[model samples]
Target: MTTTPARERTRHEIVRQAMGLFQDRGYSAVSLQDIASAAGCSKATVLYHFNGKAAVLAAVLEPAAADLAALVAAADQLSRAAAQEFAIGEFTDLAVRYRGVMDVVQELIPFIQEMPELALLVADGIRLKGFLAGSDDPLEQDLAGFALNGLTAECRHADGRTDEELHRLCEAALNRLFRPS
Candidate 1:
């Protein structure tokens, strides 16, 4: 059965509240009661909306997962230069856009193998090997990987910076990394 408007509103509230908690404090540290309290709802209401904390995590991750999936798909249509531009630049923008979730994502990076959604999000990882025009150059692969991790880890609170500025910074680093000896 579908949820009523009021119920759906409550559910959205619960998810929003839970995401804030999960981002503020690691997922392991957040409790259902905390979400309910933050959302101004009862524990039972929170449960009625989501079966458990894991479901809330899934809801929180859905947007980023979708964005990542789309980025990977778009990168498929292009190779090498285009792939690098799209993957690294867009990914850096994504990190800044979802500043709250970035910390949670960082925490989950290690256990991505256990989370199929995250695995799917990071599966191609700009490599696209066996997909389309895959690169075999170790240097190209290493630089992309390095840029991905470096950008995500270093930048989250982009309060004073613009998205274009961030992308420009990432592009600069990528150029340096992809530079030939």
Candidate 2:
């Protein structure tokens, strides 16, 4: 369907407001009225633009999800070591760029398995974890992957840090995590 400019603008606004609400309040705590209030639209207008809250959440997460999928696909084509470096760099870039979304995603973990719209993100996350770990042993790789994931997620909560600063900090921590012992 061809979206009129006004409709597109309203959709964008809804997604933008939904992202902040989801980040600040968590998905379960946010209501259609809350999103509508933040977006300066009526709840029915929100429903007109999106099917419901889950749809709004999907729209809010779409950009970051697309970037992550692309990163995973690109990294999948490289050698193990090259993929590791590529994934780490790309993942840190994503983590910093989508810090708020990262927090939302972290909060959504408990529900991700049940959200069909988030299935690609969940799969890409698994692939990204493997690339980030870059270890030969299964146990070591799992441990390293979880640590890297936790580190990136926690860094998003570093108040008062600029994006550049967060990028550097996350990149350095990731590199150190993957560095040979």
Candidate 3:
């Protein structure tokens, strides 16, 4: 379903509230009523804006997916270290920009992995599959190494880790991933 300009604000509210609900509780744990309550709207209102929970999830995920693709596109020109730095910086920036959306994305990993088609969608559209796939380092070709980012995202809520700390952590992980083998 498409969102019209007039209803865009409401749509944004619903998605934003839903994103928070997803982060606080796991995606499956959140119901439409839960989101509506958090959004200060009725369930019917949310349903009116989005067909269902999945549609809400789609709306929330769409931009993040696009941003991941943009990250991949931007990393295409740099050296291995440069690309890793860029990817880590952008990845951390994305997490900060999206307001807990990383929680949603990380939570979806199991479902994405279980469904090959969904996995392909994430890999192609989200670009998280091969975060630094084009890097000069062969180690960067593997998606598993990127899990460190997910862990970092999950734990970043803890005290003492500033945004700079998160970036440094991500960058260090990138370096570790691309370390000479």
Per-residue lDDT value at 67 in model 1? 81
Q: Give a tens-digit lDDT track for model 1, residues 1-181.
A: 9757988888888888888899788888999999999999999988887778777787887788778777778887886667755665666667677767766777776776676545565575444322222356666566556666666665555556676776677657755665334
Q: Identify the superior model by TM-score, candidate 1 or candidate 2.
A: 2
Which digits, one per residue and each the tens of the lDDT, describe model 2 over residues 125-172?
888888888767798578766865685576658688988888888888
Ranking by TM-score: 2, 1, 3
Highest lDDT among the candidates is held by which one? Answer: 2
Residue 135 deviation, candidate 2, in Å?
Answer: 3.8
The alpha-carbon lDDT assigned to residue 55 of candidate 2 equals 85
What residue pairs clash in candidate 3, if any at all? none
What TM-score, over all chains together, does every model reach? 0.77, 0.90, 0.72
Candidate 2 backbone overlaps, count: 0
RMSD in Å for model 3: 4.7
* Candidate 3, residue 98: lDDT: 61
Clash counts for the predictions, in order: 0, 0, 0
Stretches > 4 Å off in candidate 3: 1-6, 77-85, 113-121, 124-140, 143-159
